[model samples]
Target: MTRTPETPLPSLKERRRLREAQSLSQADVAAAVGVTRATVRSWENGRTTPRGTTRDAYARLLTGAEEVTPHQENPAPALVGAATGPVQTSPDRAEPTPEPPSETSPASELAPTLEPALGPEPEPGPDAELEPLSPSLTPDQAFDALYAFCAPALVRQTYLLTGRRELARESVERAFQLAWHRWPEVAMDRDPAGWVRATAYEFALSPWHRLRPRHRNPEPPPAAPADRALLDVLLQLPPVYRRTLLLYDGVGLNLPETAAETEASTPAAANRLLHAREAVATRLPELAEPKELHRRLAEVASAERLRPAKPTTVRWGGEQRARHWTRAAIAFTVVLIGATTLTLRTAPDHYEPPLAPGATVHGVPPRVAPGPLSAEELALRAKLKGEIASGPERLVPEAG
Candidate 1:
């Protein structure tokens, strides 16, 4: 029922005439067609065009074929009776039907001028086959779809970032775990693999890895001597330079994507990649050419393919999220309680002596309201009052 955008839609003038002939209100037509009244108005005013099932249903409704549902695949045009030509109206009619628009009629003047001829919409029949609602992708399906496509390359990229194979696998597994936990957002992205790769790359660099001395052991020797040499040289470079080389050359990302993954500007990423290549070329002169360097690095990087065991079922949409929120809320409350306890325990504890009958403690300031001014202030006020009453005469006499 979806019309190709290239197909010419029914003319606004023809649609208006047909709807008037049917004596249908715009609201009545919108309700029948499952669209807004404004949408129906847009169709008749030529402000916009309708496509898909909505358009087909609108055509059928206006032409008095309300029983005919639009085909799921391709739909045939609806035949509009007496509306394809001029409309006839009687003068005595409370709302006269409008004639077909002419060259003289402005688009703004187009309005519904018809009484309701079609009675209330008919209820669905018991035997009717209503349109099937599209099934939503389950979390397991979404996770599998992304995991199958991204895991191997993501593991390889992680290995390239960190020189250790086992560490690379661990980082990749962690990234996939997090991705599953937030699959809805991850699936909606343009490059789900890119997100995984970026995440795996960051995980490989986490400081927590330093605590595990076992990770320091060298992985099995590379199959090729050239690859071994390349891996050794890459490990010696700074992390930023190493990542830029792997993402740009080893993983085959473009300069911009490389920069984005590395959290650097495009120009800065390009500069780092250039330096990284030169740094590698210095250690191995045979890889001086850019193409040869990328080829060698890619060969070394692709040495391992990671395939983690598939989860039996990835708990998809909200259940996993709700549990996570619940845990987080619990942890937050525990921390708040612990902080309150610690603060109370560490606070200064002072003992105060009981106050005498008329004595006030400094720790608690007096709450008495303000009273009369001090003697010095009262004396000054009385002098000012006398001077004000004497006015200009007192001032002249004092000057004399």
Candidate 2:
């Protein structure tokens, strides 16, 4: 009387539990195998038999078993039937059970079935209207999306730097405009909105633009606004000090990046940053109250939210581009003309008629003899000629 071990069968509930343990829903598994959830549910409930490829997929997914066609009958006895046979344990008398083929491994079957669903999803059309106020961004979208994304932080930063709502808004808008011109390139950059904010900060600090004749008035200076008094003091500091303060305190750039951006050594940038901090601390006591400063910042940021988006009708199309080229061409022509004219005016003139022969010496022409010299003149000429002939001989020592 030998005992035979029972072959255990997995229950439907157990199969479902296994699927759940693998982090797959019935619908997900169905989708993977191009079947309906209802079909998957029926399989899991054991309500219907899965056939053909579906059966093969199920066997592979659930138990790592090869798909056996309905026509192909197994010669070996079923495990359930084998359990009824008498147990025998002698090595030479042992019956060999055929193992399932390795091609039907669970991982291999499931992996192939699951990969198609995880590939890159197609993007929505360009003209598709975005969800209202959501950041549903596209590659070719306008710069307005970027502006909306960083508006809050930019407003806060601008207020912190300028302490004036109007100036802050202007500065931020100008920076955004500059970025918009290069939007195609900038939008692809990581943290593009942050780059714009940094550009805005630099723009606001530029002395040529910020303190230019266009920004100034001929009238007498008015009393400094209380909220912006500290900002005024900060502006009065040297440009290097201002940049160091803004980079360190306002934007939180580290010393090395700041030094690289400002073209200063790390130690020099650090010193400038330290001096700026000290200057701000020293000036804070004489400027606006802390509460007032905070209130101004909040007010400016609130105002920025209320500011309406500009009309997008302004076009920089081919016509304008052509016009720019035309202007450049005209400018180049003018420069060429001016350069040629200046060269002609400054160049020396070397043309002169050859001098006439027998030109007057000092305003008197040479006296022409009216006739041949008289005898007296001839004798004088002869005596002068004789002196000229004997002069060299007389100069030589006589016989010595």
Question: Which candidate gets the maximum lDDT versus the true structure?
Answer: 1
Query: All candidates' lDDT scores?
Result: 0.61, 0.50
**Model 1: per-residue lDDT, tens digit, 262-334?**
8775557756866887788899999865556656655665555545445443233335656888999999999
Q: Can you give the TM-score per candidate against the true fold? A: 0.48, 0.40
Top TM-score: which candidate number?
A: 1
Residue pairs that clash (backbone atoms under 3 angstroms), model 1:
none
**What range of 10 consecutive residues in model 2 has the weakest lDDT sum?**
110-119
lDDT of 2 by residue, 46-162 (tens): 644455555556656665343222122112211111112222322221122223324433211110111111112211111111223334665335565556555545655565565
